[model samples]
Target chain A: MTFLSASLEQSPSTAEEEAYLYLQRGLRLCRYKPGDRLIPEEIAAEIGMSRMPVREAFRRLAAEGLVTLRPNRGCIVAGLTLDEIYETFEIRSVLEGLAVRLAVPKMDADAFLDLERLLDRMERAGQTGSSDWVVRHQEFHALIYTLSGRPNLIRKINALHVVIEPYMRFWFDYVDKPLSAREEHERLIRAFAQGDALHADQIMQEHILGTAPLLAEFASPVRR
Target chain B: MTFLSASLEQSPSTAEEEAYLYLQRGLRLCRYKPGDRLIPEEIAAEIGMSRMPVREAFRRLAAEGLVTLRPNRGCIVAGLTLDEIYETFEIRSVLEGLAVRLAVPKMDADAFLDLERLLDRMERAGQTGSSDWVVRHQEFHALIYTLSGRPNLIRKINALHVVIEPYMRFWFDYVDKPLSAREEHERLIRAFAQGDALHADQIMQEHILGTAPLLAEFASPVRR
Candidate 1:
């Protein structure tokens, strides 16, 4: 079910970068829950690095909105409210829509093959109910942005993704229907194959916006 | 031609906040050029604060993309290349467009009055060729985002504005027809007055995208 190995190939060049990556991965994987305070000395001990790098990483993560640094208290992972989650998704819908529109004409056969392969991997992961499914799912969308050749746009989109990842993790855990994403992504791939930029853009927008109600449902009192 | 008074009433609370505001104002006013190295000791001395607060300000500015933090080297003002400029404007267009659309339905007479007053200030600044013109122009646009009532959306828009402000300083310094912005603002105001969200959105998008060519021309070899 794993499309690519779970391991990231790029090694950290410095202790700071290493700490940043370690904390970033932890945040993305939901190992650190929102509002959880990050202790520099403890993290440094766990990662076999000094507190300096961990402190620097905290500053960087704080800038990225993954955490907030209090004036006196240490950094804490940012918790999203329901309204914040909707706003994040709304911004994503437009940015990802623009990415798809820009990417459609630029996509070649090799890009299509890569997307198909990722889709297949996603489907398999869904059937097996593996955690890798979420990873591949994100990759599939990221690949579209990569083809758009807009690194700044991709960077902004990815920032929004990081902020929303925790809510998405909630959705995956509590939501009943897990297999819907495969069908939605299938429509997106079909639009890409047809070379319909507008259609692809619409599909991507709907695909992102569709998550709002599900997330809202998850946040509702009944679900709690 | 003068709009409202040029004074910002909100004073900095902490030495760190004061230092951050001081450096931010300097950068936006073009007091420090791109790639200019910031010396914490010198700035602290100049601002009559301790170097500790100034150093902390550098970290904050670096997080905001106003400065780059090198490994051994001190922080330097970020320089934008031609590609970065265009990418920044492109992202701003869509985000601002969304903001206008959201704000249009929420608009009231008081909001229009506030916008008109800001526009008046901007027009005066345009006529007098005052530096405050740029400040007011930014405020006029920011007012629209404030009316959107989406704080996260406004935050993203403001972040992009910070990144693009230096390039705008370039455009104002080099470009000949500075009055064109006044005319564009007039059109946007008319659209806002009519409560035409679609028209306002389209105008906002075009208004932002229209600057690309002018900025590109400003960056061209002939100008240099």
Candidate 2:
């Protein structure tokens, strides 16, 4: 399958932005595994771009903690250790809980409908064992943050999510039962519909933390 | 004043680590104000180092959101806006609250004594109107995190503190009354002594959030 979508390729911007997005997509899709060296020339060639833009993308990704740049060595994808995974989810629970509490009181009927539609999409994707399920699940959470009226909080939450995405993918693949995903989403939707902000907050905290143990089991020691 | 202490200068490591600590100290002391362009050669000359180490320091600082590295141009100190100030404190409250709850149950008698000593130092610094008050105050909070036995959480809390340090300096300067600082510490200490983890958590959350309004009033629009 092609890494770059036609729409992303056709968008107007500097080469750096395109390259950054290209590399980000590849990382998200696990096209580049953790500790894998990223050679700028090869990436630039694959995307029909120059090495300069790809090099710039490497620096940007490094800044975001997605990659590490060694002095004499090239850039490599960053890995999360067991402790780091627990740390990431611990923060995620609090931040996402705050988002739910802030969003529920302000959510209107249309917002509820949007969440329902996204939940439906996630359910279908899960039943079919489609990779797009994770994408839809992220959108569902992102929608809740967008309704909260705090763009800064959303940015911070998204950053934490990006760092943990690969491990999350690992968890999804190794775990046989995908049944909990749908049930949890349904419970959250019900809490939102009832206008129970506190309950929704608690559910979010538990939902995020519930996966911690399973993910921790799969985490390997991070390579320095 | 000399930017680097004798110990820091004499310590063994790569040029990059030394340069990073030097720049971090400068930023913390407000030697480099927000929006000030950082010239690698000038910093290198001041520290008796080369431009390469200074350049690496810039990249590390940028990763921490402490500086902005503009393409084609040089790096500049990053400024916080009103919204960012509020957001930082919001997250700080939650994380610090978590720290207090986690630390209080595990704190030993020696830990309590250390906290008391730090509080005493802070009180003295406040009464004398010494600039070292913030340093002591940060140490007091850091001690609490250290006692919690969670190094990862401490690192995350410290990262948030670094981003907000300059604005905190602004807040400390513009507000003359330091009485609240002492009183708040006393209350937190009392809660810890009583072994009331939940109460300590609440006090921490309130203490951090209480300063948000005053700091928000002093924040300027971030320079693009």
Candidate 3:
């Protein structure tokens, strides 16, 4: 989407964009693990494109901090240390908190209704134990943040979400606990409903920061 | 700098890297203003390079949000709205505050001395009304934040600083005020010397956030 649209000189139909989107989705979905080598030739064959576009996509992902390009070893999935991951959560907490605070003044009754509806869908997806739950959950938060009217701040926050999405997916798929964020979502919505910007900001920060330790504890064993 | 080192596929001597450094320094130093058109051919001629590498450098800068690329209008320096500029300062406030908090535990007596020395250089530069003051001012803050041991966080903060740097330069050049941040910075160092992380963080956040209104007030007339 608009994240790196500036880098796409051609239309969305271009091979490089296609490769980028594909790899980005794979990474977000946890299909690509940290430290995994990305073979351009193999991806090219799978996508029915040449190696050049795939390599170009690698370079793009490298710039985005999604992958690392070693001098002689080619591109590898970018790995974050536990502390780095914690720092990322810390960064996101303040940023998303800022987003919530900014979004409060802009929120209308219709916006509140929209958030509730998204929360309903997210809860339903969670009850069903469908992987659709994660998508809806992300959509729910993103909807609120998008109203902040700060594109640059939102962009940085979204990039942070992308970096940790795989860990989130890992936690959901591997952990045995039931999805229990419905209550947290309800409280956040209530905060917004009350038009308590500071309260919402604080809730948003703690909600995000609270997850870092849990994710780190659960995902450490499998992180390569 | 490590800001966009991942985008440089070749050695530092490459034409593209040279163009990038040239443009970046120009942007950072206020030689390039908001809404300025970047003509690759003209820049190439000026730098004794082909237009291709200059264009490549433009693409990189576009990705970094320093410039915007239009369909037919080529590249122009990115111009932020007053609100966006305010938000940028807000984001920097929280981030740099976090950096100070994290850096506190890691800070040593030697680090405090280093910060004082940089402050001395910055104050002397300010007293002389030397433009070198801005560089040393940046260096002073950067040194404190770098000790946070969070490269990702520091990089994001640095990028924000770059975006607002020209405005800072404009304020210093066009406004009629003595460079009077010496006392404020001395207080920050005092906070650090006392090992007061929370106080330091609060001071850092306020220090950064306080700049937005002044910069917006001063630069509004000059902005296109």
i-RMS for every candidate: 2.3, 3.4, 2.6
lDDT accuracy of residue B168 in candidate 2: 67
Ordered from best to worst lDDT, the candidate numbers read: 3, 1, 2
The best candidate in terms of DockQ: 1
Q: For each predicted model, how many residue pairs clash, with residues at least 3 apart or on different chains?
A: 2, 0, 0
Pairs that collide in candidate 3 are none
Candidate order by TM-score, decreasing, is 3, 1, 2
- Provide the lDDT at B218 for model 1: 76
For model 2, how does the per-residue alpha-carbon lDDT over B109-176 read when each residue is reduced to its tens digit? 99999999998887777542356776777678878987877665666677777777666666667767
Flag the better candidate by TM-score, 2 or 3: 3
TM-score of 3: 0.84
Off by over 4 Å in 3: A1-13, A30-32, A37-56, A70-73, A124-130, A176-180, B1-13, B30-33, B36-55, B70-73, B120-129, B176-180
Judged by lDDT against the true structure, how good is candidate 3?
Answer: 0.78
Please provide, for model 3 over B1-224, each residue's C-alpha lDDT reduced to its tens digit, 9 standing for 90 to 100. 22333443354656766898889888877678788899989999988999877866775677678888765578899877788789889898889888998888899989988998988888666453356776677677778878998889887886776677777767878765444467678888888888899888888887877777888998785576
True contacts kept of 2: 0.30
Instruction: Compute DockQ for each candidate against the true complex.
Output: 0.46, 0.33, 0.44
Candidate models: Cα lDDT each: 0.77, 0.76, 0.78
